[model samples]
Target: MEISSQIPWSTIAAVISWYSSNIGVLLLNKYLLTNYGFAYPVFLTLCHMTACSVLSYIAVSVMDVVPFQSIQSRTQLVKICGLSVVFCFSVVCGNISLKYIPVSFNQAIGATTPFFTAVFAYLVSRKREAWITYGTLVPVVAGVIIATGGEPSFHLFGFLICVSATAARAFKSVLQGILLSSEGEKLNSMNLLMYMAPIAMVVLLPAAILMEDKVIWITIEIARNDIRVVWLLLFSSSLAFFVNLTNFLVTKHTSPLTLQVLGNAKGAVAVGVSILVFKNPVSVVGMMGYGLTVIGVILYTETKKRYRL
Candidate 1:
């Protein structure tokens, strides 16, 4: 069967959007927190959630990007809140990890997301894939391990937090699938962001304030000193909203496992981009590891197509 016949243009568009926005946000977050001396991951993440809330609201309510979806039941509302909580945690942890690690190494750690996603899919939803399909993940993960060995700036604390963030991300994907599996509970990507973004802000605000001292004042001070910082924040926040939107769209059109598979390829691309943008040193071993990941992703895609899994 032809690939185009199997996959809709909208799904491909969503995937492309996801790749661009995700990479852009990660790079910006790294630059802001580490090189740019912003140094407040939690507060920065709060800004992203705030942008998501406001932009998502305008997109849904005023622009009519998708039909407005009200919380149907107490149960659905609870599920959305739970998702928001996880989303907030994952994003903040991801930002914090970037403060201590290079984006390339960060992507190396993030490559493990497929493993966590596959495990969570089984445990949370009892979903299973063919053994052959599972085999494809080995190279995807092994490549990351090889890349990690090549990283010069590996921090144990950063590595741990990145792993935690990756696991949280995988769990969120599986949880979203389980919580919104019902026909009535299912929401379009835009509408889902409309509800999730604000709730995530509510969940994140207290933690941001408590963990980061004088963040508001510091942000203001930074903005006053350099208007460029303000522009960067706005640009990063806008990218963050698109990141969430495209993520939901991809997960909606495809299974969580496929999303994770795509993410492996994405990690390889991120590593390449980081090298170019930041001029981070990558050993020959790292490049070889990335090559393996690319091969694994292609094999995974072919396996899915051949077996129609």
Candidate 2:
């Protein structure tokens, strides 16, 4: 196969793990919110971030998969916190969006993140993508627009929050590269995560308190009544950690470009799994739009790769 020939077996493993973790966590979150009636997106995200911090800490401090180092400067600390705030917002919005929209539509909306990233890069960084790269985004945007129009499960508020989450994610990516890409400051995945998790918790605590804390007592009782719910939450949280770990591995082995290309397929995979698992309705026209978006993503990846951007 072309993939077996081109990608190392280890990289293939990483990619598989990445997809599994992403899809698994998403399905679990959907179940928690919809099936279990745990209506606390911010709190759930806080729990996942807590789990990630514990996992990263164990890897760095105990297993020594990555070395533990303290971030020294206030400026650097502020930057990490800033990134965390954006990350927390994006993730929480993503979860909330899922509460109101089907996973397939949510993932489809997320497929537009790259387009927003390019738009932001153009506006804020004055970076010029290749014309083809720019051209390819046309279909990406158009497909999302088409898909949005036809999506049977579309909710305007959910759509807006999902769009906001996608934009926040793009902004987070750009800001991270601009602020934290320095070799002297760079921490590997585990260590960077070690710092980011607590910061996200700190940043998220207030929001969770403001939004979800009102029902906190009742949700706690429900979680206690159902031990399986607790376990599922823990499982989803652990999968969240694996998602980042495997994403790092794949990106390290293959290029970020390869990971991006792989991610385009991930959208379709998530959609397919959601349909099979959740029995969410999808029209032929909607799928055509999703297919257009995936094709656009491939074209966009090729454009960026061809120009070495």
Alpha carbon lDDT of each predicted model: 0.85, 0.87
The TM-score measured for candidate 2 stands at 0.94
Which of the numbered candidates is closest to the native, going by highest lDDT?
Answer: 2
* Runs of candidate 2 exceeding 4 Å displacement: 1-8
**Which pairs of residues collide in model 1?**
none
lDDT of 2 by residue, 149-208 (tens): 889988999999999999999998888878787877776777888899988988777888
Give TM-scores for every candidate, taking all chains together and pairing residue i with residue i.
0.87, 0.94
Give the alpha carbon lDDT tens digit for every residue of 1-309 in model 1. Answer: 997899998999999999999999999999999889899998888899889989999988998766798889999999999998898889889999999989988877776666788889988878887788788888878887787787777788998899899899989989998999999999877788788888888877888788998888888888888999989999999999998778877988898678857876787788889889989777988777767766766676667566644
Give RMSD to native, each candidate: 3.6, 1.9
Error of 2 at 118 (Å): 0.9
Positional deviation of residue 296's Cα in model 1 after best superposition, in angstroms = 2.8
